[model samples]
Structures are given as structure tokens and as C-alpha cells.
Target: MQQNSLKLNSDKTQLLLIGSKSTLTKTNNLTLNIDGISVSPSHQARNLGVIFDSTLSLEPHIRQLVKISFFHLRNIAKIRPSLTPPTAEKLIHPFVSSRLDYCNSLLYGISNTSMNKLQLVQNAAARLLTHTKSWHHITPVLKDLHWLPVSHRISYKILTLTYKALHQLVPPYLSELLSPYQPHRSLRSTSARLLFTPTSKLRSFGDRAFSRAAPKLWNSLPILIRDSDSITTFQSRLKTHLFSSAYP
Candidate 1:
């Protein structure tokens, strides 16, 4: 009799863990029938069904399924892909609208406090699309405030993208910004300092017009020369190409 009672208690514990219930005859420990098969209560069984449904959505594209799985997986990839198309595109756009918006929101006194550096680049690029005249306004935000380093970084990454598009043609106000990177030391000396930094992209567009010649000449140079002279020349040239002001 004790062994049979132990078995009944163990079975009841298991059913309780699963939140099972049924209607039948009764004891304080178990619901039963007149036939005497004790069972769980009805409400418990229905609750379990609801729990399963809540855990998974039946949406097309398995949208919920992708989102839930990717939430934990963003570390491994641009799991943003799992987000719906509209949401993914929106996140890629920069959060701010104008220089004033950037100043108010993104330009905290200290650098580390900022978030959304990447988003700033995207939004800045979009603004540039309408106003290349405002490249002066946008470049510092990329170089000093927002701090990004790619044309490939996003569709319209700030400096490098603007560099590829305009080169020496970027405005004088913007060209002045390039002066710090010029080869000689001071801004006042930087006038003919452009001569020192032959690599300075901040030149007259006419001088830079044939500038694409370097790539073609690059292959003719020796491999060791490339690693040394090529790098030096490239760096100088890159500075000149990207930041030069003497273009139309």
C-alpha cells in the first residue's frame, strides 16, 4: 500500500510541474472520476496551449521567427538583415537633418558620450545629396565630430565619399579644412605648402584632372617600390586628391 501511494505522489508531482489539470471526481491532491482515474484540472491544460502559441508567431516571411533569432545573433553578423526591409532601410539613414540638428544632438562636449556615430554618417550623406554646397558643413562632422573613415562604410560615408566625388573641386572653405593634413606645418605657410604636398588633393581641378594617372603608373613600379615609395606617394596623393580646393 505504501509503494502504491508513493507512485501516485510521484506522478502528481510530474503533472504539477507541467501545469496540467482536468475535471473528474476529486481529492485535495487530485481531480478524479467516479471511475476513479485522477487527472489534472481543465484550466491548466488550456493555459499550456496558450503559452506555446505566444512563443511563436505564424507571420509570413517568418518575420517574428527571424527577429527573435537575430536579436541574440547581432553579434555574429549584420543581423539587421533579419529585420523587415523597411525597418532595415530606415536604420541605415542618418538620424539628423541639418548642421544645427547635428550640433544640438550629436556634438556633446566629450566624444565618448555619443552613440549613433554610424547613423550620423548616413544622415549626413543624405543631406549632402541635396546640398554639396554644404560639404563645408558636413566634412568636419565626419572628421572631428562624427568620426567615420570610409566611402565603403555606407552609401554616403562623409569624407571619403565626398573625396571620391569632388576631389580638388571641394570648396575653399572645405579645402582650408584639408590644410592641417598638408605636408608643411602651418596654415599661413600652406599657400605654396601645396607644392610641398604634391599629394595634396586640395589643388586646382585642372591640375588634378589628369590625377587618375597614378593608378595606371602604379603597376609599372617594382613590388618593393610599391611597399615603400608607393605608400608614401599614395598617402601624399590621397591627401591632395581628397581635400584639394582648386576644382570646379
Candidate 2:
């Protein structure tokens, strides 16, 4: 305020303490005062449409998505009998799947239980769009809609970001996280570039970091996909690859 000539809006200010479960437990009751205004700690905070919990578990976020998405899914399901598959898919993607994919990169390395919750939401969306029976296998339905499973969607988001970062299409903050994967003996003759995934002591947290997940997902791609010079081409091929993997 003194330097920039701007005043802090204490009333609108919120504080969040992020940490592991045990770490959060220790600071759960902690509080702070900024310029004599008490800043209460929040168990969960929403930033850029993504919810972050104290434990970084994302359960609250997932529950919120599930609640809102299912409301739309049910409403759409009621009207599905009167709509064509293409029309239903268009509505479903914007309303339901969009929510699932929003900021989903944060969900990288999340537990299977949490992944399953989102998957169920997507499965429901697919079935509702295609008017498939509840007992039908979801694999075929997802394939028909050309939709990647929830987990693959997350990876897709990460890898897409990674590609942009690698190609200098995104900001330095993201591009700095990636480094070309180098072999000890030098395999520089390879067609497409690979990325090195940094290791961390904190497995759960580290595993989900863009630095780790980006390279891991990047390296998993076929050489042709990785070698794609055009972002559009890469995304197209990557989606096809993921769709095949999901349904096959």
C-alpha cells in the first residue's frame, strides 16, 4: 500500500494454509491479523475455479463438481429422448465434461477412489448422451462419443500444457519446469525430444507436480506423436491414442 499507493481490502482478503494432513492438523486453529484486520483461515479455497483444501486432497472440489455435473446430467437425461446423439453430445460436453476437465491437471496422481468419482460422472454423461442402458459397458459408450476416460483427460490436459511449455508457447513459469530428457550415452539422434522428470522425496505431492507428470506423460507418447511439430497435430494424434488406449 505504501509503495504502490493501493490499499488492501481486508474484508475481501482470505487466507489459506496448505499442507499435508498432519501438517494441516498442526495449523488448523492458527489465525493471523493483517494491518489490524483478522484474517480467518479457510479449510478450502477456490482459486481460478479450482478448489484447494488444506490437505490438498481435492475431495471438496470433486464433490462440488459431482454435485453440479449430476444436476445437469439428470436434466439432460430427461430430455435425451427428444434429442439426437450429436446434439446431446454437444450439450453434454459443454455442461458436464467441461466441468470434469476444468483445472483437472491438479488431479494428476490423485488416488483411484477420487478418480473413480469423476469417472462415474463422465460415464453417466456418456450414457446420458448416447442413451445407453445403465447395465451397458462404458468402454463402448465412451468410444462411441470419442471421449477419453477421466484419468486420460487429466493426462491429456497436462501433456497439452507441457507441449505448449516446451515449445515456448506458454509463459516462462511453465516452460522452465521442463527439461529435455538426456541419456547418459547421448541418444541425440532420436526423432522427437523427450523430457526429464525430476524426482522428489515427497512422493504424493511430487508425483502430481507438473515437472514430474509432464515428462512422464510426454515420454509415454509414441515417437510420432512426440515428434509432432504442430500443436494441433499433436493434440489430435494424442487424443486418438488415448481414446484407443481407453477403449481397447
Whole-structure CA lDDT of model 2: 0.86
lDDT of 1 by residue, 1-248 (tens): 56666334433422222211222223255544322555553322122112111111112112322343233233322544365544543443332222212212111111221223434434344333323344355554444323232322221223222242224554555344332225434565343212111343423221222232222233333333334333345444444443332121
RMSD of each: 25.9, 1.9
| lDDT scores in order | 0.32, 0.86
Winning model by TM-score: 2
Write candidate 2's Cα lDDT for 1-248 as tens digits. 67999988888787889777777767645778877988989878889988898778899999999999999988987888899888988898889988998898999988899999999999888777776899988887777667788998998999899889988999999999999866777565344588887998787788888998898899888889988889999999999898888877
Q: What TM-score fits each model? A: 0.20, 0.92
Top candidate (lDDT): 2
Instruction: Count clashes in each candidate, considering only residues at least 3 apart in sequence or on different chains.
Output: 18, 0
The 10-residue segment of model 2 with minimum total lDDT is 183-192
